[model samples]
Target: MAPAQAQMGTIFLLFIGISKAINDVQMLKPIDLSIEVLILGEVLLSWKPNVNPELESYVVKYNVLIKTPMKEEQYTTQNNSTKRMVALHKGLCAQVCAVYYEREKETARSQWAKAKLQAPPGANGTSITNLSCVIYTEASNNTAMDCSWLPGEEAPEDTQYFLFYRYNIHLEECQNYSRSHDGKRHSSCQFAKTDIQITEDTIVVIYVNGSSKHSTIKPFDQLFNPSTIERINPPMNITVALKQESLCAEWMKPVSVWPSPCFTYEINVSDWVTGSTKQLTVKDNSICLLTNSQSRYSVQVRAAGSDLCGNSKQWSAWSKPVFSDKPQKASVLLLLFLVYGALAGIMLLSAVLCTRFQLHRRLFPQVPAPRNPFKDLLSYNEAPTEGALEVISDIDDPEPNE
Candidate 1:
């Protein structure tokens, strides 16, 4: 009986030691760990499942503890929900702890992860509420002649977000300016003088910073001065008409007048035959009338003023010669009449001779009878019937008898 009792006691002691060892293994199991931190104005902390075969749920604890050279501060808060880990703290230091669990068993808790949170080096703290321009130009004749913006400390990595200009004719100068708002690289800008005709009063200038949201505004001066004329093209047009006593001339304006302003025009008229010239100046109109009636004349117009930059517009194409009608004599008429009469007489005589010849041919159409042959053979006193045969026979018989 004593030996059986001693054997039971030894078995009991061994069983208790084995149960403690299993509990110790469960507590000391190595767990996986993952941590993430983000810094804005405040530090943001997040975590993922640290176990293989991911846990169904997790419990997260976060705290900000700082150990500076001068002092220390602890900021710890328990977030005991069974969800993924996410936390935010606006303090100097942060600590995150997560406990993962499966559906059937409680997994081990991960080791604490610590982080320090502080403001960025150059945090200004004040947001740019608004950005705009103060002064701008909007006139038609007077342009936004020149423009500029405030310079920056450094050149921006990207130049697209630099300053720009806007011109609006309807609204006030202050309302026309707009700035960029995208968070791109920043750059500085300068202005260049331009040649334009602005007739309105207000102009606006816009200033843009690196982040685009930060911008300012400024007003521009109103330009009302007269525009400068450069040069004319193709010159002008001039024409002349002859009246009874005087030569009337007209002209057209220069076609290529840049920066147009009010102008005074003058014309120089000269007579080619008489060797005399006259000058006539007219107001802001292009046309001019000259009244020096002559047989031959030439006229030209020139525009001159202090507001013009270059020489006066050249004179127009020359005017044509003008002349009056003179009376013609009657001697040429008499000579023409005499020549016509002589031609008529020669034609009449030819017609008369031709008519007489036709009449004679019609009256004597028959051939004339042959002349009497025996009558022409005898002399004027000889008888027409004479027998010479008897006399010839008597003369022959007498010669035979001898």
Candidate 2:
């Protein structure tokens, strides 16, 4: 009796499974899945539902799958249409299916209907390549943007590229264009503070299209998040001071056109005495180290967007290095230099004066000489009287001879 009961149960399960299979086979799929371009990079996907009032009325929802050249996405909605922002340069493929859910459980699903959009075809390597962009957010909340790209390998000499971007509802063109290679083709573009608006929910769309005399230059488009591509300025007012036992480093966050909730900091401290270096990562703008002694230190601080704007991998450049007690030491050194310089100048002047006086004495020496003009005449007269005496003595001896 037990074996017969088991057989009956197995047959019942088989009947249910067969009935389900037949029901699924007869279920109709969604019809006429279509894509409509709302804007440059935004599109709408819509389809007609398979409506049958004879079937039990359960809420139907759609499952949408999007395939792009770079990535894929899936979404579920109760409506027959959905909107999305995506790059349209390479086109995309979208598929939608209706799912039947009863009592919060999936009861059945229909077949998938697919649609395709074909981008304007061109030569293989005629599209722009290696495009990059950056947004500069200053401390005063001023903003600017810069973008650059390289021409495709098969691009022609006369190929000129134009750039357009959109973040919110307004699409803007590049006005301050920077050209490359003899100014023949535009390779870069710049935007002023008034051109863009950025927020946490903003999505940036960049498009590049080109024209050439020889060939058709294929266009390229890309999507970006403002926070991810932003180049944050380094932390300002960075100062390190010695407070009691710890060397405390403090700074202010970078200013930008939009306010940021918080920031992460990197403080690199180098000990002048120990000849060692340290890397410190912190969430706040201030940090302190207990060096035990009053040893001088060198420090630099750099910052990045944090919290809602957090980007751990993208860090600003390190700030210029600041040293503990550097200002006092510099002033002392300068004062000593001035004092020593003045003393040396004085000594040099005295030495020169003494040397000049000694040189004068050696060039003109004192001598004992007669000052009277008639002294030489007196001497001549005395020398002549001696010759006269000798002549008189000879005359006296001549009398004896007579």
Each prediction's TM-score versus the true structure = 0.22, 0.73
lDDT of 2 by residue, 310-362 (tens): 34337888889988895347557877999999999999987797697885466
lDDT of 1 by residue, 1-402 (tens): 999999999989976775454335422222232223331111234433233333323333333334433345555445321121121122244445544443433344445655554422211322121232221122232223222233233323233233444333222222232233453432222222233332223223232323323432111112122222122222245555555555555555444323335344666666665787777777443433444432356666665432334333333333343332210122345557778988998888867876868754676577899999787667555644665333324444455654
Worst 10 residues of 2 by lDDT: 389-398
Backbone clashes in candidate 2 total 4
**lDDT of all predictions, in order shown?**
0.39, 0.80
